[model samples]
Target chain A: MPPTGLEAVFLANRDKLVRFLTARGAGDAAEDLVQDLWLKVAGRMDGPIANPLAYLYRAADMLMIDRYRSRRQAELREQDWAEGQGPEAPPGTERAVAARQTAEQVAATLAGLGERTATVFRRVRVDGIAQRQVAAELGVSISTIESDLRMAAHALAALKERIG
Target chain B: MSQDRNSPMHGVDTVAIDWALRMADPARADWDAFTDWLEADPGHAERYDRAAMTLLDAEQALAAHPDVPVPIEPEPVRRRPLRWIGGAVAAALVGAIGVTAWQDRPQPYAIETAAGQTRRIPLSDGSVVTLAGLSRIELDHAEPRRAMLSRGEALFQVRHDARHPFAVQAGAVALVDLGTVFDVRLGQQTRVAVAEGAVMVDPKGAALRLDAGQAVTVEGDRLIRSTVQPDEVGGWREGRLAFDGAPLGMVAEDVSRFLAQPVTVAAAIATRPFRGTIDLEAVRHDPAVLGPLMDVKVRRVASGWTLEPRE
Candidate 1:
């Protein structure tokens, strides 16, 4: 379908990208990457592309993989930075390391949540935007937007339950 | 209704409950059309009131248990969308009252898994989740356990996390161990199969640590564990479920994914387990080839099909 809106694009890719990402490495990573993807898709120069859903999701997946690599590189850089910082700074470095790991894990998990819902949820929750304007810009009714939130909430809740 | 809005949506009307849950959630545009519809006259509001009471009761039960991670509606998401209404709804409600008056929510995770329908869920966590046929899991996670597999079997290859430890709760079985990959099922029976690392299979207060190359079947509180190769139990990860020496009923449960709803097997044949591998790609197009092999028959029932073992 033509990508008139970001919602259609995000939904089409959400399932496929989840499966695709899980298989790659970031299985249940985080909502950040997905959010990032949505933002990128929405901000893309391509106003309306062919197979918008598939193309956007593919880009998100690629971004996820890149994110993974960046994380790895950051970890290595940190390790190298620590080694160069002398043996005197041990305990302080350890705490920093732990905090970094937690943040990374959280980021990965957020990224895994994908575009549409992730963006909507984050913008509303993280940015605290009202839902009406969210719907207006996305060009959907309030009810449809509610459905997305409901679906995301149920899915996320289930995910938390299965693992926690 | 306010006092008991947390009750589980068991046997409750799906539509009203679903919408109510949506209303409670923070992500959506705050001005719910469904809520307006329900509140338009008063009859709709009453029905919503009834469902809301049950949902509230369920949430209360979940909230009582702190360790359990209840689904937290992202208020951060909710705060502004009401603003985005261009300040219409809020500007309207300002002179009126509290937030509780707003909800009209989604049915409490209205999941319907038939006896043989294997529904796969790719979670927000990036974890691949599969709900086995005839499984009915209560998506009531406002409690300690992330999910309560109320009446069926489910396999979870949990995304590893100590902070948000993945947990699968069955009646007498609670698998909340920290590990890489694991499969959990709770229905007519409770079982936990670990493909890697180790999973703590806790039945009531009893704890059993099942390591890689090990599987366990928990019937009631009894944890029956055995040493088995990880490969044997890891087939589900590949989208192919292999059943070796499983009874006909058991086999039918796994194979029913090929059908719409689960087709039941006779009580006599329920004890007759079959051994085979179900490949989605190979058999997805035609379940006919695989169904008859186990002396089972496939017949369309309503919009879906039912599997019947030849009489």
Candidate 2:
């Protein structure tokens, strides 16, 4: 039997969706999201929807945005603690040296990012702005905001691999 | 480096960063799906945590000396955001004195062993070293007993000295004895296995404190932690070579080392898994003994011995 249009879309882009979510910082969770997405599509879709791929991408993107929005405050609190807290030891201490190395590596990694991506990364990570807000201010769509964040994060992960 | 982009985790890193960035926002959030993502994979949360921790660390370092103004600052903040960071680091260093302690200095004394050879050397301190075959180590009798394993492996029976810690550096990784008996093997990859007591392993920026019967593999930037049987700590030194589903190629390498003869595997059998033990002393005289046991035909080539699949 010929696969339905929805099934065909799911088959073709399922791996791409996982890769997309994974690049976006889902890590292992990306697999689960894909599974969840599959379940959502299989269980709910009885009628034909126009542009299933776009709908799928939008649905996945929305799911991620919702996930991010759900725990936004606590994450912000942790970010404030990490960013605002003073270095535990005095200057030149071993802690400082370690921190300095980490800082240098992070700086070097961020320096290598694309100009726009770097700016987006800094605004979200350093300035602690919401992705939605960054998109609003920069006159870009939320999808662009997500993509930029993913690129920045992927770079940071590579940095960790280089130094960790 | 080539594998960095194509790695599966890179995709996850993006999602993790996305979530981290979103969480940092002041907007209201629903954390259930986020928790679901974290709970889905064992490494997902850990990777995210590391990225988040690194960001926090950079932030803390940048904010270290907010009061101390940097000399010769850039006029426009946007022109050089890095200058601000440099100023912060310099300000932090202003109060620091004699940071030379972290530099790597040349050690004075050295000990090395050849193929099929082992040595038990006593140090100035109470620590005793059992050097492995084809291993080299440099010794430093300073306040903290230090040794650099340049090649091969060594088993250390360190006496408890709280005032002076015993440390061994293997490549970028360092194993610090917190009063323990541990065997550290340096090769293509460094492996540290603790027999008795505990040891702390520092690989680049990450640190792991291993207890008795624990082992870790330090390969490049990755540290793989695993459990080790106490008896398996220094199995090679006991005249026994054991293989636990090890590749035939590696087995051949060990066989070569033990027999002091070149034992190369045919390309076809290189990856074949070999299990069971080879009594090195018994096989020392007849290198061909491995042929029957490994189910291979050992052919004595002009260059060395080659193990090929049996007909």
Candidate 3:
């Protein structure tokens, strides 16, 4: 079917909003969400949308609610799988620093490290992912991921030495 | 640093905490890159300050409990806002996801704001941003963890992203985010200020930083910083507006805020200078009359307008 004026409006906004919705845990549902909103906008043509962009944003937000419900279950599972007994440490102190076991305190110090180091640490400790998976996700060699993880560990240890 | 790793969409807090843990265990290649990152900026020291404090606390908590303390939600200061956000969240999820795509390209985060209200937002990549009033921040959540401070002010409690150093736009300044808790305010110019951490307030074309115990007010193209008391900067978080030797024109404008009517200033009083802080709303209701200064004259321009510099 040749696209209609209203359909054009729907088409125009669909791709753009999909990315917007993705941030709110709807990364996978951009398509379905866009379709649902198109129907409503067309149905409610009581008057032309004065500011189409604003209307489109308003509509996109509405679609996210349904998408969130469907996505929530998946998200909870994914999160649990990723986190472990990592840095739930007591705040950094000489004693706590000496006892350094929890991942949170270690993570805080890692704030000074580079992005890749932090990512490697997060994946290995918090997510319980293997070095290979971390490497693959970052598009780096598995050895590279392994190396980064080691360096982060050293930074944490060095931090421990300074304070502990 | 341009590491824009794919990251989580929601509940970034947990994701961030988790990542902090893994980074502590068996060192990885990413760690060496982090060392390079530390060498890249000077304020990296500030970034570690709070996290260091937290680390200290985590030690205490663990020593005492040997288990993760169940985080208690703070008592609600205002139920109305949360209820509104809850309603808005529901409505957006129902329809906003798609509409956003239709209007704007995919962004990391979609934000909505209320008049005279501010928010501290947590982005998908585990970075925290404090949003100012009437501002909208968009996040890409993709490689490089891109974000735009559409308008208003924001405080970025950025998660340490080595590959993708977070960035914020404060007018002419392209606030290149290092790991830190820094504030970006939208006004005559983008204001960059830091609290617990340091930030490189790179103005793209200029150089300035709004570091801890200091504030950088940028207007037009120039950025200037003045060292002030810590809480004096962004005091609104504590429900007060703090100012130090602020100009008369800006002070009066702030005083006349939130009224159904716009506050006016006459040419004579526009250039006068004043210094002090009072309740913004209270002053607007009953303005504290600015007594005359030798350098400038203050005159009543209209029923509510004040004119400075009677020249």
Candidate 4:
């Protein structure tokens, strides 16, 4: 079987692509995004492109834009929920009940985080402190703070999934 | 949403966390990678949303209680002011506006500052908070005189209120003011220095009383006591960062907070200690400009800027 155009592009620019993403602030997730891009190209390769390299970069760029937009909108919605002004479902509605229950579970999970981890996460998420600033305040490396936040986030995500 | 219950993308909690942190402090390079992750799989966006929502939910729940739990502090005494303030605020809003407007009232607000940006916030209670750059503070009016310092530094002038004592919670430590002017810096450790009057610092289970010219810093469960000068309180308010024999790396960190761009030090010069003041009034924000003042070489790096030993 012949290799697809995207496969060739990925083979050529995978390292460059990951480096590009990392420089942009993807942190450690750049590898995952690039791998996913490769998979996407491999799966959807109908034929060779006129400019495979340009196409891959463009595709990646578009993906990032879409993610940014959706994430911003989601943040606004989350803010609304936090302020208790989310779309009013009837008090007894399943969605409302579920949201309340999920919030409780998330709070419990957060309360259960390790002392240092919880403090770091609270400062960033609740106190709205910057991650770099938190690291400096704690006299730890920025990566350490990021990892602590990641630990809290993963715990909350697990709780969210479990509650669902 | 359809396909695999067992797929790896279905469980993207770590990736979501990474995205969250990056989004909070994104560089020019992060957005492209973020978009790639979002576009890479159907489950990725969903997981991110879930994680973000969960975090938001937890914050809201935690904020509802005026007395937030600290890692080492004993259980908080249930304060009656919470109930009283809830009713009072609700009543005041309904009386001033209508019930509908009061129902839609905003949460007790939070103010955040970018690096190099400072804000002086006057609370409803007349207490003043001078928030330094790269800092965050939340004012829950129901919690009234209390504020939470998440990161960075703040100089607080608490209006003397015996009925409702002013308190500031920074990470795992709590600072209760005894009618004083004080500065609290929330960094790797929490430092509380009283410029006038006194302060009671509760770190873990022990409470230490700090009087004027006294300061204490909490690292994990350990409390270190030290002396502070009155001039050192809110020194950043005058556009100056005074370091007393602080390491070069720590000095660089303070400078980074003052400038729009960050400056990283070479490992060799990171720990060299210096006791002096960096006058922000006279210097440009460039590390290269600062190198001469500090006896170092500042060079532009691909990442941003790096400081090295001067030849």
Question: Which of the numbered candidates is closest to the native, going by highest lDDT?
Answer: 4
Model 4's DockQ?
Answer: 0.11
Candidate 4 per-residue lDDT over residues B1-311, each given as its tens digit? 12323343333344565565556543312545565666666566555555555566666655554254444432222222222223443343235434444455455778999988889998877889999888999886544566878778889988866555676777666666766789988764467777655676762235566655556756554666654444566787888777655668777776666667677889999888776677765544445667776788889877567889988
Ranking by DockQ: 4, 2, 1, 3
Least accurate 10 contiguous residues by lDDT in model 3 chain B: B74-83
Instruction: Write one digit per residue (lDDT tens) for candidate 3, span A1-164.
Output: 87856566667766666655544335576577667777777788776655565566445544544344345446655666678533343356855655444444554444434456566656665555777778788898875565555444434543443354
DockQ each: 0.04, 0.10, 0.02, 0.11
Badly placed stretches (over 4 Å) of model 2 are A1-164, B1-107, B141-144
Per-residue lDDT tens digits for candidate 4, residues A1-164, read 86556686678888877765554445588899888777776687676687676667645544554566577667777877899988454466786566566555555444444456667877877787877788888887776676666656655655545454
List, residue by residue over B1-311, the lDDT tens digit for candidate 2: 01121233422344555555554443523344554665566555445555555455444544553332222221111111112212443233222312342253634788887877889988867789888777788875432266778887788999866555666677556666776789887655577887656687761235465655556766555565544445567777788776655679877776666566577899999989997788888777787888889999989998678999999
lDDT of each: 0.51, 0.63, 0.49, 0.64
> Mind sharing the TM-score for model 2?
0.42
The candidate that wins on DockQ is: 4
Fold similarity of candidate 2's chain A to the true chain A, as a TM-score: 0.43
Which portion of correct inter-chain contacts appears in model 3? 0.01
lDDT of residue A154 for candidate 2: 50
Q: Model 4 segments beyond 4 Å from truth? A: A1-164, B1-106
Model 3 lDDT, residue B296, Cα: 42
